[model samples]
Target: MVIDRRSVQRAALVVLPLVLFVAARAVSAVGDGPLQNGNFEDSPDQSQMSGSVVAGEHAISGWKTSGHIELVCSGQKQGDMVLTVPDGAQALRLGAGASIEQQISGLTQGSYYSLTFAASRTCSQDETLSVTAAPAPSGAGSPAPAQTGELPMQTVYTSIGWDSYSWAFRAEGAGLMSVVITHNCGQEEDPACGPIVDAFAIKALHDQPPDQAAADNNMLRNGGFEEGPYIPPGSPWGVLVPPVDEDPVSPLPGWKVMAYKKSVRYVDSAHFAVPRGARAVELVSGVEAALLQEVDTTVEGSWYRLEFSAGDAANGCASSSDGSSSSGMKLKAYAGTSETTVDIDFRGAGGSNRGKIEFRAAASPTRVVFVSLGYHTKSDNSGTLCGPVVDDVSLVPIPPPYARRLLL
Candidate 1:
C-alpha cells in the first residue's frame, strides 16, 4: 500500500492549529482590563447599519446588541444638538429597551469585580442605565442569579455633561460570563433619545487582610486611596464612587460612600494633586460627598488618633467665576463622639495640610467619617464641581505613656 505523504502533511497543518487554539483559550484569564471594543470604536459596516441604528445582533464587534442600538460619531448632530462622545471618536447610544452584552471567558468563580463605564444622557431629563452580570451555565445544578443595578443619569456631576461610574458584581459559577448594559427608558416624544455610553472597563477587587497595613501605624487598609478601580487614560474627571456602593464590593476598598444622592470623586495624581499618594478622594459635593469606614480598634474604649491631609486638588478649584481667587476649604472629621474640623486656605499651588483628631473608641469597630463643608466649583470653569483633596489617612491607638486625659 502506498501512503500519500502530501495528504498526511496537509491534514497535520490544519489539525495542529485548531489544537493549539483550544489549548490557548483554556488557559487564558480575563482579569483587570478593558473589554474588546470597549470604546465602541470598531463600528459596524454599511451593510450592518440602518442609518445610525445597528441592524444585526453581531453588528458591533465583540458584542451582541438588541433593540435600537445606534452607533454615534463625535460631533454628530441631531437637529441642532451635537452628540459628544465620552472617549474615542465613536460611542454607543442605547435606545429604550436597547442593550449590549459581551461574553467574557476565564473569570474566577466568586471573585468580586468592579465595572467602570462612561455615560451621558442625550435628550431625556430622567434617563437610567441598567447593568447586569449573568453567569454562564456550569454543569452543576443551577446557574447563579444575575446581579443587576440601575444607574441614574439625572445628575450631571461634571462640567462636560458626562461622568464615569463604578459598580460591583461577583463572578459566579462560570466558564463564560456576560456583562450587559441596557437603557431603561427615554423621552416620551422620542424613544430613540437615550444615553450615550463608552469606555467600558473592569477591575478585580480584593479586601485586605486584617492588620495588613498596621505596620505603618495605620489601622485602615487602602487609607492612602491607592487601591481602587482602574482609571482610564486621559480621564481627568476621575471615577465616581456612588453612595449605593458598600464596603464589601466598593471600588474604593475598605471605605464606603455614605451620601445618598451624590458620589465622591476618586482623583489620581496624573490629573489632580493628590496629597500623599497617587490617588485621593475629592469631596466635590460638599456634605453630600462623604467617606465612611468602620475600623477595628485593638482595645475597646482605647484612645485613638486619626490623622489625614486636606487641601485643594489645585485643578482650578480656587478661582471664582468673576476671576477672583478664594480658596477657603473646610473638612470635618468625625470618630465616635469626637469631631474636628480642618480648614485650608488653598491658593491652588498644589499642596496639602494635615489634620488630626484624637478620640476614644466607643466600641471595638469605630466608625470614622469625613465630609466636606462648603460647596465649590473650579475657578476656570464655574460649571465644573471641584473640592478639597483628602489623603494619607492614618489611625492608630495612642500608647499608654503618651495618652492624655480629655476634659470634655
Candidate 2:
C-alpha cells in the first residue's frame, strides 16, 4: 500500500519539536548535574555515577577503589541521579552497611547499611534524609525486585564506612547508575548535609601512605607498628591507643601488671593487687607503667627501677614478674639507657617474681630515674618474656621528681 506523503509530513512536524525539546533538556541537565550522583562506595564501581566526568557529550568514568573520590552537579542539587548502567536489576540489600563514620578521640558514630535494591528511574530521601529507594518495593524493608532476565546483578552487602561524606564508598552495576544526594551528619547526622544533595561521589575517601623515613623500619629488627625503638621525648613516640572495647586499669604507684600485644587476657585484670594502702606515688608517665613490677635476678644484678615514667632520658627500667625472680619467669620491662656504668636497678622487691615493669625518662639525661629496689631472687632471664607495658603517654611531675616552683 502506498503511504500518503502529506500525512507523513504532518506527523513529522508534530513529533520533531518534542524530540528536539527532550534532547535539549537532557543535554542541559547533563551540563548542570551533580558530580557524585550515585549510591556507590569508594571501592571499584565509581564510573557508574549518574553525572560522571563528561568530555563534550560523552562521560569519562572508571572503576573506583578505597581512595579519594569526588563528584559534582550543576543545574540543581536536588532530585535523584542515575550513575550506572541501565539494567533490569534490583538494588543491593544492606544488612548492616555503613555509609558514614565519624571518629573523635574515643567516640565513633555512623550508619550500618544492609539495603535491598531494585530497578527504578530515580532514588529519593525523605525530608528527614533517611535514604530510600524509589518505587518502594512490595516488602516494606526488602531489596528491590530483580531485573527480568538480565545479567545477575553484582551484589555488595558489606559493612564499610568513610571518615567523611555519607560512607566510604558507593557502587551500582549492570544498570544506569544513579545517586540521591545527601550531606554529612555531624557524627549524629548533619542536617546541613541535606535540604538538597550537595555533591555525591564514589571517591570521597582516602588514606595517606606511610612516611618514607619509617618505611624501612617495617623490615628492621627495631619496632613493629606501635612497637618500636625507645621513642624519646620531643619525638612522636609509638604508643598503643587502646581500643574502644578495652577497659584500661590503673593501680597504685608501686603496683604493676604484665601484658603484650599478642596477649591481652592476662593484663585485662590485676593479678597481684596493690591493696588499698599500698604506697601509690605519682611517678612520671612513659617511664614506668609496668603491668608486672618485679625484681630481675637473671643478670648478676638484682636491682631494677619502678615501672613507669613519662620521660625517656631518665635512665630507668620497668618490668613485671610472677614475683621477683627472672629465670623461667614472666616479666616485661621498658628499659632505658643505663647511661652510667653503675646500674641503678629498679627492683620488684615486694614480690618474688617481677610480673611487669616500665622504664622511661625525660629527654634530658638527668630527668630519667632508676628507682632501684634492693630485691633479690634466684630466678634468671633464661625464659623471661620481659618487656614494658604501656600506651600513648604524657608526663606529669610529682613531689620529689616534679621540681615545683611557685608561680605568680
Best by TM-score: 1
Expressed as tens digits, the lDDT of each residue in 117-140 for candidate 2 is 121111222222223212222344
- For candidate 2, the per-residue lDDT at 156 reads 13
Assess candidate 2 and give its lDDT.
0.23
* Candidate whose lDDT is highest: 1
Q: Residue-wise lDDT of candidate 1 within 60-115, one digit each (tens)? A: 99899999888999999978888889998999989888999988877778777888
Per candidate, the number of residue pairs that clash is: 1, 129
Weakest lDDT window of 10 consecutive positions for candidate 1: 318-327
Full-model lDDT, candidate 1: 0.82
lDDT scores for all predictions?
Answer: 0.82, 0.23
lDDT of 2 at 78: 26
